[model samples]
Target: MPNLIAATYAPLQSNGTLQLNGIEYYTKYLTHNRIKGVFVNGSTGDFVSLSIQERKELLTAWHQNKPNGFQIINHVGHTSLPLAQELAAHSIGKADAISALAPYYYPITNNNLLIQYCKSIAEAAPELPFYYYHIPVLSKIQIDIVAFMKRAKTEIPNFAGLKFTENNLMGFTHCLHNSTDNQNIMFGVDEMFLPSLGSGAHSWVGSTYNQIAPLYQAIANSFTVGQHQKAASLQQKAIRFVEILVAYGSFLGVAKGLLDYLGLPLGPSRFPHTNLTTNVYSKIMRTLENEGIAPYLGNLP
Candidate 1:
């Protein structure tokens, strides 16, 4: 498991077509900054807004340009089980691992159905490790992950672990400590990452890691050296980064805009997610600088 896996954005052109040519730059930027992997076609990538072919293109682009030592975990979740399976089958040789969110439209409240849904997808790409993307906030299926893990262990042979995205540290802790197998449970809440570290999490996957790998690395280093206050302060800075972006518009949308500063022009976000104008982009940069976060942004291209 990678220490920091960035949930990447889906690059688009002005006309909303896939801007896959930019993946080389994106891959290099993350590698140079020491990011370990990418969680593609996930929420940060605006997967819901993208079509099946578009999603496959994003995964193909990332896989093609993947740097050495960097992993790509493709999220193949869809409301349609058949579509999800199609995606899973497509990712066989392309992705290092595959994950899927619970079906959101009808919502599977029963753990059995959830496991079955996962089982079907896992079977589609029997060669790849499968992770259940447990983001209850979006999926609205608040099933206990610990229970899900127990059932999945018996049923789903290729179940790798979870992309645990909820803020329930208690639940996350239970999943980590009480699992029958050694699960690779990567923490997903970016704002509360410090506490997750304290709870003994080594790996994390989040949108913020795309831009601030150095900052999170600093926090990890500080914690390792017992610099408690320093680590906490750095965590607060991360929280503020999300806060500042959300103030302008959708944090994810604004984050896609920020990637331009690193030299990968990902173009604007899709509908309902705010896209920054040139003036707004400059203003945000100035704000980040004023807020003392510029230095922690790592080496920008």
Candidate 2:
């Protein structure tokens, strides 16, 4: 099966503290939904807002509770090289793989710095495969991903793949074309999953996979079996899901609210991400129901 890894949320209490006890439930939720893996401490997890200690705890909790064969890719990107390396080192045995992003605050002006940044982190966990998290919109270090990746294959031994969240299909295709036999280039745009499938992409990671994995899985299956029309319709439905959440202001904030409404209880978003009011969740559900998206959602509690 093509990998559908969820870029998981950081479950927190109403008071904004880590809900450490919820990891077990979270694991079963992903497994039950047919997801192949979890990408913890990534953009969806609000890694920048979390403390290093809290990230360690999240990693530990997921690693300890993960069922057999459930892959865990830990994101250890940070502004500080030492801290990023420390987190990467920490993931040596706890994570099935490790990924890192460039230092965003001091945006890398050159590809050399970016590759070196990733190279240093990869060195810390020689045992596990390393992926470069190429989320340029957030990282703002928009170097040529293809060129960097080519050099990285030679420069970083354990370099395994990339999590491409940018909207550049051209670059993604080139990266795909240039990928080594041992490497994977995981597409990160959930709404564009069908197009990715058409482009020969078999690996994906995203937040929507948490709620609508079954929907995407169907999309993949349809696309595979000469069901292009059916795949396109399902892709539209998946896009509608994102459109509805975006209509209500911050998508991240209302996203967790939707999870709560469905009984997953991911709790509120951290500061700046903006969680929707409980009163508004029902309206969101109504919108989803009216759009015929509720039918395709993965099983609810």
Candidate 3:
């Protein structure tokens, strides 16, 4: 129950300016729904796209104005150790805890490499709890989860838990069951919430929460209170919206489009990630219009 529901804040723009709504909308979303946390600079937050200074600014604003009682989990993953360390240090006093993925765009060896990398980071900010991020699809280095957990417990005591973003929920569940039950486990996939929770997931980080936080809160609490049917129904709604978005284009573009529709100045995604094409744009607009997702856009801020 420690700020269980979290929104992944994505800040990307062709222009130099960071859209303040990327910050404000989530803060306002949290306030409106009485949700508890805001996760900044994660995969959905587009952490790798922003400069260190931009990441710092977003974190600063969240620290300053996040609704009272809301926890902030800052993702500080970077290819450079120095930069990652500096960002981890910066996030220490600003947020409740922090996270970092296995260094991306590089081939890595065994769990030892990951253990050493995470330990070095854990050593840098001894004051804050550092959650290890596991997104093999993005990082390309799947640290054997069981092996990583074993080493973390013995080597880095400051190593708190994991933000598992892999598509393999069953495998992740096996890892969870095989490891220490006390270690906190947060699910990364938005669509797999119910199964993950049923499998004993404790926390979650999702991009869709940025848009439909109240609905997620309802689903999460519904599960907690033994309302599995209701939780599934709510989660179904979330999945439906996500399907529509993906059918239009990439998840990132759809998320950005949602933000844009909300009146936020969050511009288009970076190159190699083009905006929706004409036909796709029309389909997205039509889907949004049909779904009444516009009302939720207004609810964001």
Candidate 4:
């Protein structure tokens, strides 16, 4: 079975305060949906908008509340290398694994500096496995991916794999093919989940999995059974599901609003990511129902 990890959101009150109280319900919701685990404090979590203290508090809350056997991947990436290392160290015993994207502001294109940044963090949390987040679009830290993966495995003692978020399937495939180690390459693209199957990706991470795992799970099942037409149909539905959320404003905020409708009520998002009104949520529901995508969203209590 393919592994699906939800890149979780930072639940906040309408006043924008941390909704740590919601962690239990969040855990139940994901587990009820059969999600394998969570990738916390990533892009979806609005990590940049959160303070270091808030991020630390979130990591602790998640670890304390996580269901047994569920992996907690803590994203420790920051523009400051020292702070990134501090987060990595802070995650000791709290995180099942630690991950970090490249420093975005004044991003480094040099593969050596990139590896060094990861190495410093990995060293700080020598006990936990480290994953390099490869979302160049956000990090602006593009290099020869195949080469970076090779060097990361060689250089970092605790290097596990990558959260391969980019669409460079050729590089992704090559890295997968040439690897003989235990290092993983968990794919992070939602639309390419089916295509990643072709590249031997057994693990995937995304936010849409929060609301529509069944739709994607159905896609995986269909493909496994040679049901190409049905699989494509479901994948298209998954894409449209995302499109509908995006059609509102910020996909993250609107998605959190969907969680509210589904019964979790995780609360509002921070600025620049606009949360929807109650009326707008009704409109989204109608649109989803009209598109036949409503049934796949499991209700959470």
Candidate 5:
């Protein structure tokens, strides 16, 4: 079975304080939905907006509260190499694996420099598996994954794979097919996951999995049974759901708001990401129910 790893949100209080209390419920919510693992401190967690201390605290809370058998892949990527190394070292024993994105401020256009950046972090957490988070749209360092894997093989001993977040399936496929080590290249685009599955992708990491695990799970089941039509229909619904929510406001904030309906109030999104007001959430919920997408959501407790 493919791994469903949720790129979790950083829970916050109304005043925008870190609400570690929410991790307990967050764990239960994901487990109930059959999510196998978590990708914390990534895009969904608003990592760029958070302080190092808050990120560490979030990691500590997740480490403390994560259910047995649940995997935690803490994202330790930072613009500062030293900070990234520090965060990686901090996850030594707590995280099941650690991942870092390419440096974005002064993007590493060269694959060799990217390898060096990853090497530094991987060495910091020598005991943990390391993944390079390859989201070029965000990092602006659109290097070839196959080349990165080739270099990583000889350079970084702890390199496990990539949190493959780009939409370039051709490159993604090459990484999967040509990798000498058979690394864990997790697909990251939530809306186009079915195509990735068609390409033999067995693991996925995305924010939508946090809310719509059952919908995607059903899609996977349909595909497994050779029900292509059913799977495609469900995939359309998944796509439509993203469209509807993204239309409301900041996609991340709107998604975080939906968590409240799932019985976990994750609070408002941080700066630059608009948090949905209660009225807005109510209207969105009503629209979802009207559109027949509410049944795919987690049950309200």
Candidate 6:
């Protein structure tokens, strides 16, 4: 049951500071959704906008409220190593695992700096399993798969896995071939679940699981438990759902709407993200209705 089904939480905004509801709401959200773990302050959670203290609060809150048997993966990536270290240290005893990304909003050279950067953060939380989050789209930094594995072994001791979000299937094959001691490779995209799992992605963490966790779990079970056909059928349905949701607007807006529709109090995107158009909203709603997932919409406001 340790196989991870993690949710990326959007920190609530309050009076210019990120405010996460205390244990009550956090625990309620996880329990009701049957989530296996939490991935706070990750890309889907809008990690870029949160301050270090706010991120720490979210991590601590999850550690305190998460149901027994549930785990946490603290995402401590930041533009500065110092801040990343602070979050990592704060999560030392609080989270089961910790992950960090290549520093973004700046240019970087080779896999050397990226490896060194992740190594420094992992060192801060030596006892926790560390995962390297590779989201090339946002970070603008790509690590050579082979180079990363070679350096990780020498420099990062507690390195446990990686979140490879790149959609290149060929690239994924190459990375798995480069693993040492069953190093876990988690796929980050929602729509690629089947192919990713088929290609040997042992674990995953993503945003849509907040609302569509059951569907994701079904897809995973189908493949792992001798229902390949069922998994493929469900995978097609899930991908179609993801495509329609994203088509309605920016990924953040659509995801927030889904969270709201599910009666989760995730609120709107903090800022720098725009609202969806009326036509797109109507179209999305129609798609939901057609797909029979409207019952989960509950009492959306």
Which of the numbered candidates is closest to the native, going by highest lDDT?
2
> 142-226, model 1: which lDDT tens digit per residue?
8878989988887988888999999988988988886544568989999889899888787899999888889999988898899
Assess candidate 4 and give its lDDT.
0.89
Candidate 5 Cα misplacement greater than 4 A, ranges: 180-182
What TM-score goes with each of the models? 0.97, 0.98, 0.85, 0.98, 0.97, 0.87
Q: Across residues 1-301, which tens digit of lDDT does each residue of candidate 3 receive? A: 3244555545555563676555665577556655668778877767777889989988998887776777888888789988888898898779888888888777666887888888887777887878898888888885678778877888987777888888897778877776665577778888887778788777787777666666666777899999999889877777877888877567776766666655555677764444754466666667766875534333544
Q: What are the per-model C-alpha RMSD values against the true structure?
A: 1.4, 1.0, 3.1, 1.0, 1.2, 3.1
| Pairs that collide, model 3 | none
Candidate 1 regions with alpha-carbon error over 4 angstroms: 180-182
Q: Lowest summed lDDT over 10 consecutive residues: which window, candidate 5?
A: 292-301
The TM-score of predicted model 1 comes to 0.97
Q: What Cα-based lDDT does every candidate model obtain?
A: 0.89, 0.90, 0.74, 0.89, 0.89, 0.74
Locate the minimum summed-lDDT window of 10 residues in model 6: 292-301
lDDT of 4 by residue, 208-230 (tens): 98999888888889999999899
Q: lDDT for model 2, please.
A: 0.90
- Give one clash count per candidate, in the order shown: 0, 0, 0, 0, 0, 0
The ten-residue window of minimal lDDT in model 2 covers 292-301
Residue 215, candidate 4: alpha-carbon lDDT: 87
